[model samples]
Target: MTGVSLGFIPEPLLVALDHILPSRRLPSTVFDSRKFRQIKASIEEIGLIEPLSVTAMDQATGNYVLLDGHVRLLVMQNLGLVDAVCLVATDDESYTYNNRLNRLSTIQEHIMICRAVDRGISPERLAKALAIDITSILKKLSLLKGICTEAAELLGDRQFSSDLSRVLRKMKPTRQVECVELMVAANNVTVAYAEALLVATPVARLVEGKKPARLAGISPEQMARMESEMGNLQAQYRLVEQTYGQDVLNLVLAKGYLAKLLENESVTRHLQQHYPDLLTEFGVVVETVSLDRRHFAETT
Candidate 1:
């Protein structure tokens, strides 16, 4: 940071805080009332030790730009204080002030770091100041790198990066977005389950006989577990197949994922590819997208 010696002239008047602060200095869809309430109460009781920073707009406008401490200034203004001390800080200096140390990130925190860079802060500089590994920072940025605006809209604090990464990792951008729509339409977003559905749905449609898989109303975790258990069964069967051949294992351990899969033609190939050794230890999941579509088609 550059050492600065700048003088402050304190002159403040009541102005709409919203007008004074331009667009958000950060990417925030949610303004936490609980945190703000606590902060407001604390400032009202103890008084503001750190002064707010502001800049003059112009000679005629009688407006000032708040560079930092918007929350504290708003609290004071709401309390009917006519004027409070404000320091003059350049917008450049304003970005670096009072940011806390980073711990493991919540989704929002990671988003903000990218937003900061998108606003023209250098990634190297921003990463250093944020005290995060640059590689991880870049990896998270890659999550939305080529995601269509349509698909990216489906992403948010909880699963934005993760979900986008999952789909984009496997398919073309157009297909990635299509997958994202299904994910949101189902009100769910996670990598494995989304991928499973993406692969499962179309195949189920194309298969000639029997109905498609039932994909909806199932959480990613459940699908993952089902796959895991099915994997164990496959391993057992494979051992049996090796010792006694397919005829014996098919007799005892056969009526699980494979039976269910064989019952449907469309997603059978997908199950074979993504989950080899269906009942072995590789795990397999019944293709749900196909099943649900079939159920709907039949009911109709």
Candidate 2:
């Protein structure tokens, strides 16, 4: 097999701030944003951790087009920095570097924090660098303490509140996995949803067989009803999940057939004259670009 091509050069180059040109303009309000503040604070506390991604130098001007790290560039400029390390990309296109980025998930963040602490980085120093409280840093360091391997793996690529792990920790490993799967399937992995799942969990499924605390304004009867409803929902979700692939295949086949059928002049004319609504509906199905849930809902 052929080797994969590298987008940027392996070694970073020291480029002057004046030699790097931003690809886009930043709004004035960006300076006051929380993200910008955090990035600035991080840079101030520990210096720039990530190098600026730039295109190959233009020999005419002896400058590089800044592909990524515009905010960092602005921060360094505000701090009166003259030079920065830059990664020189092979191509000038910034789409892949800018738009097609994978953000760190909550679990991934936790793992990195743990690794950093293990590598002798103090929680206080990390909190300062991240512009967060030391307590928050400690909380992130212990994010996966009671979470099961399976549940943690399920949430590896997902971004959710660190507090969600607190709710999962109350349940047994099997129940944690089940609840995580349910939350993932429903695409609602918030702390609130996790708490609801905790409430619906059977006492036996909880750690130490303890009952889930009653939520305020909800009586035992209402809680029981919620549990029953949650069970039914999970059952239905599993049933749908099992058949989702086959359903998609059938829809694709049907869409292709309808598209071909609508292509014939005689058939299109007959449908227009006798069954205009059906023809319109068929046209919608044929025109759908993807088999995603949103598209399916819109078509239906």
RMSD list, candidates in order? 22.6, 3.6
Q: Which residue segments of model 1 deviate by more than 4 Å?
A: 1-115, 118-120, 156-159, 201-300
Q: For residues 139-240, what per-residue lDDT tens digits would candidate 2 score against the true structure? A: 898899899999999998999988998899999998899899999887899999998898887777888686644555677797788888978988898899
Candidate 1 local lDDT, 170-215, one digit each (tens): 5555556556655654556766656564444332222232222455
TM-score for each of the candidates? 0.30, 0.86
lDDT of each: 0.54, 0.87
What is the RMSD, in Å, between candidate 1 and the native fold over all Cα? Answer: 22.6
Model 2 stretches astray by more than 4 angstroms: 1-7, 25-33, 80-82, 94-96, 214-217, 287-300
